[model samples]
Target: MKNVLVTGFDPFGGESVNPALEAVKCLAHLKTETYAVEVREMPTVFGKALDCLYAAIEQVKPDLVICVGQAGGRPQMTVERVAINVNDARIPDNEGNQPIDTPVVPGGPVGYWSTLPIKAIVQELNRQGVPAAVSHTAGTFVCNHVFYGLMHYIAESKAAIRGGFIHIPYLPEQAARQPGQPSMALETIVKGLKIAIDVAVELEEDIVTMGGQIS
Candidate 1:
């Protein structure tokens, strides 16, 4: 069976819980005939997040890696298409570090495309009655840092691993605290993540779909 490693960040921004980590914690040892899933919790800090991810990758030796992060205002699960090498944090991280326009890896490439079948995962999630879409950006926070670091590690080490990042909406409880914010139920988020994993494992290439933004 193919080994799959999924990661989520710890709660940041002073919230009680992080839906991404909670959902991943619920998916331990989720195994099927084709693939087996292992979960890891990454720090919300920029540099340390990548360090944790690299350790997890070494320990799990997974064929595929999906890193999930919380995107509070997003209404649906978004499979990121790219990870840029910039680190421009809008706010301080959990450790109170705020980087302004620093490259994630100095002198590295500008960006890295996700190796996973992003469109296929989005299509499958929508087919399963889950809200999902293809996202072009993973943001310039710790999420993007880890994503770019993972792709760079794969490229530099020549590892046979397909990796990508997914952003999930805030939980209902998290939204309850901030009025007028959109959120999705935990069950729905977990369902969407499982569907994404299944589709990513089954499909080799992304399907041709019109998933673009006008803005």
Candidate 2:
């Protein structure tokens, strides 16, 4: 069975349950004849996020890596298109560190495009009655930092790891506190992620050979 490494962040922004972790955990239970899944949690802080992500990638040596994060106001699972080299956090991270207009990695490329088949994944989710879209920005927060770091490592290393990031919406309970915040059902988010992983692993061969075929 082929191995896939999935990552989600620990809770941040005073929230107790992050949908990212919950959704990925749901998908982790899927058993297949030819594929095995492993889900892990990473810190949401700038300095620690990348290190944790790298460690997972190295240990799992997965054929595909999908990083998930919380995007509170979104109404669906968003397949992020790009990760920019900037850290402009709206609030302090879990470690109480906030950076403004700083490079994710000094002297690295200005940005990195997601290696996942975003459109295909979104289409599959929508077919299952789950909301999904191709998000152009993963934001300047820790999500983007981890995304950029994963891409950077893939570019430099000889390891055959395909990486991308996904942003999930707020849980129903989280939105209840904020009168106007958009929220999605945890089950729907889980279903969307499962389809995403299946698509990611199924298309691994084409992804490696075609190189950035997602549009």
Candidate 3:
């Protein structure tokens, strides 16, 4: 069976939990007749997240990699369209590393578009009644850090390992602490991720659709 690795981050920013990890834990070792999924928890630090990601890539030698993270205010599992080649941290990472306006790779490309069928993933998730959308920015934090690193690694190594990043909203409990912030149930996030993975594995060509924002 073809192997696919799903990675998620550990808790950071003074939060006791990360929805990404929670979803990853729920998705471990998911298998079908055609492909399999292996899950790993990456550090929330800048350099170390990439290290853990690369190590997992080496270990799994997956055909696809989906990196998941928490986006506190969003109510949907937003499939990121691109990862920029910068790291500008608004706050320190888990290990207290704060990088500002630094290239993820010193001379790398400005950005990398996700190789997965992003539009298709969003379509599938919404069709299932799980909220989702195409996100234009992964942000310059650790999530973007790893996203860029993964793309750089894929480009440099000349590997056929298709990669992408997905951002999930906070869990209900996380949002409960801060009123007016939207959140999705953990099970909803898991279901959306499963659909995304399936679409990534099965659909090589992304569907043509409108997922644009004027503002």
C-alpha local distance difference test of each model:
0.94, 0.85, 0.94
Candidate that beats the other on TM-score, 1 or 2, i.e. the better one: 1
Q: How many Å off is the CA of 123 in candidate 3? A: 0.4
Cα lDDT of model 2 by residue, 1-215, tens digit: 77888898989989898888887887774678867888998888998988888888878888888999999888878898899999999999999999999999899999998888887888778878988877888999999999999999998896777889999889989999998999998888877888888888777432222113365
* Residue pairs that clash (backbone atoms under 3 angstroms), model 1: none
lDDT of 3 by residue, 22-141 (tens): 999999989998899999999999998999999999999999999999999887899999999999999999888999989999999999999999999999999999999999999999
Better of 2 and 3 by lDDT: 3
Deviating ranges (above 4 Å) for candidate 3: none
State, as a TM-score between 0 and 1, how close model 1 is to the true structure: 0.98
Better of 2 and 3 by TM-score: 3
Better of 1 and 2 by lDDT: 1
Task: Report backbone clashes per prediction.
Answer: 0, 0, 0
| Candidate numbers, best TM-score first, in rank order | 3, 1, 2
Model 3 error, position 183 (Å): 0.5
Give the clash count for model 1.
Answer: 0
